[model samples]
Target chain A: MTLQDYLPCLYALLACAGFAVMFEIKKPMFILLASATGMVSWLVFLLLHDIGSEVARYFLATMVAALFAETFARLMKAPATIFLVIGIVPLVPGGGLYYAMDALIGGNYALFAERGLDTAAFAAAIAAGVSVVTSIVRMAMTGRMNRRERETKKEE
Target chain B: MRAKQVERCLNFCCETGRQLIKNGAEIYRVEEAAKRMLSAFGYSDAEVFAIPSCIIINIHDGERNFTKNVRILRTGSNFDRLDSLNALSRKVAAKELSIEAAEAELHEIMGRKGYPAWISYLGYGFAAFFFTLFWGGHALDAAIAFFCGLLVKAAMGQMVRLKANVFFIHICASMLLVTVPVLLTALGVHIIHTDKIVIGAIMLLVPGIAITNVMRDVIIGDFITAVSKLAEVLIIALAIAIGIAIPFGILRALTGVM
Candidate 1:
């Protein structure tokens, strides 16, 4: 969409890129991928319609980003973490954590606890979803395709 | 051309070894091998470096089997400087690098710079305003709590001294540190809204934000680096917590705030 709405993601990408460059990481593609993820995330956030749309958009963007990272790792013969860290920086639950900590200190114990749980759940969902998606994709590429044939195959 | 790079590596290793020797690291020809590796990685001007305890642990833990007599320094160069040596090396040459020494040396490096004054001030300011505004704290109590937060973070950094255990140390230390100091202020021993003040003061001690970011980055799979940086951040958080928690706890019981 407009450049303004995308500023946070752009800022996130630049920050990720700056840090990666600072560390002298050799992988340039990761920086590009991270920058792209920010834009892609924003775009997905916009195009989708209603109901579970927000969650669906996040899932799709995350999956695409994760798949790209996983696939990039396979092609480059490098560790996937390099791709993951940069790509995910914007997704870090900063606002959530800040709220949780704030609620915690303010003595709104229930809100505090709930926010913390929410943050953890969000974090776990991201981690597990990416891992499972990437692993399943990898398995499919191994030429093991076929549920019916696989039933006979397992029996055999 | 390649050999010239190797020559640079060799030069760096020898030079680095000399520095360690001068510093009393009980090291041998580590500089030489490091130089070789540096050259292979394309550093033509990396003349010196210090070691990090992380590598030492890896060495001692049998993860790596470099000769015992020689102590090696571990460095993760970004090649950012190397690529621009012909252009930017002169500019960056004056910047402090990430190269470090074994535990004592690393600690010394951290200790020497001390906490940046601005960071401390921010912690203090946040402690005062945030505690009073959010936690209904009073002025004097907030001030005390804020100072306690600063003190807690500092103490943790100085006293904990536990190598890899730093993360957990930081977590517990920070949690208790923030909670307790303000508790002192709360009990009205010195100030009532102090716990809020202390927590705000040492909020920097909690690397939760940084660690979450690190994990998020890793979860996304852009792992070219940031792993070590995350570790460093975690340590800083731990130091903050340790610095605050002890005093708060003591004050709590002493003030009857328990």
Candidate 2:
């Protein structure tokens, strides 16, 4: 990949780190990890966008970010939202949402509808991606607990 | 006397849940944490219900059941408080902390100051700069966005201090964001893509945390909290859109340029 391809990832890292600071994420290590998560997710999104539909690109990127956030939360002994918020920053459709509003205000109905739908689609894709990963993790956790309980009963 | 003791335990549990919800903890997590803490304190029949804006905790101590309701008026996310509160709950669940000790620790965490105002202001500038770059803006656009971010942050801080409503604050911030770049371009400076600069600066107001929590809450079947938070997100988005639209519309009409 060209150096230009790496620029987005670098910017994502800086943006996430800035957000971590603004949100008062006290630990420097957490901030660094969160920023790295953002960078990886943005990189993945950029890579996938070249080959997939916009919705699929967002879904895959969000899944990667959410899984990373969940793993980091477990390893760091903190809430997953802390990491997830920063990780998904690079993927959130902030620009599209702004453009949708801009179009509406400028009386361009066609552009408004287009941008609005795009923004909504991206939001839905992000939600679906996070939900899928979270459910899988939850199921795994419960299954492990159930197996442990069954083993204890057998031992008794 | 026994009734008084049950009341105290219920109050403590409810207060803990309230703090969690106020600090933007998910509904399921808040309820689970409060329940675990109460059970550890010997209130084995305790039930905790939490939403984005309110928490209701019920504790039964054989002869009498106590239900306490706490209304959360304001909500913001601070990961440090979330971590400490989660740790405090774990300690309680492990039977390592008494009710009084837990209360004391919670108070200390509440009183702890976050990073100073200046650091967050600097964060606005940095976020604007990087987001501009991410949006494919050149170095000049990033620089302009950085200054615009500082201006927006200062304006927001002033509005907050004046106790202005959040919707109005958003409107004003967006207006300032678009107006700054527009005026700069009019002043003979070659700004490449003012739209990217506006987008980067607007990132400061996007409800990222609320959206994330809303999805998680929906997956966990906390529909009440999820729906309410979704409404909040939509309102904020609408406010932001209105904010941006009004200024650009007025400017286009006045100057015959967009």
Per-model DockQ: 0.07, 0.82
Residue pairs in candidate 2 whose N, alpha carbon or C atoms collide under 3 angstroms: none
What TM-score fits each model?
0.41, 0.96
TM-score attained by model 2: 0.96
Cα lDDT of model 2 by residue, B106-200, tens digit: 88998999888889888889999999999989889999888888888899889988988767888888889878887777776764688899898
Largest lDDT belongs to which candidate? 2
Docking class of 1: incorrect
Off by over 4 Å in 2: none
lDDT of 1 by residue, B1-258 (tens): 655434433433344443333222212123333444443444534443323221121021123222222243332222222222211111112232222222233234223322354554443344333333323345665556555545554555455554435556555555654655455446556525444454334443434223433443453344532365456664664355344445544554566543
Per-residue lDDT of B14 in model 1 = 42
lDDT, candidate 2, A1-156, per-residue tens: 788788889999999999898777999999999998899899899888577499999999999999999999989988888899889988889899878987887779999999999999999999899889988988898899999999999999
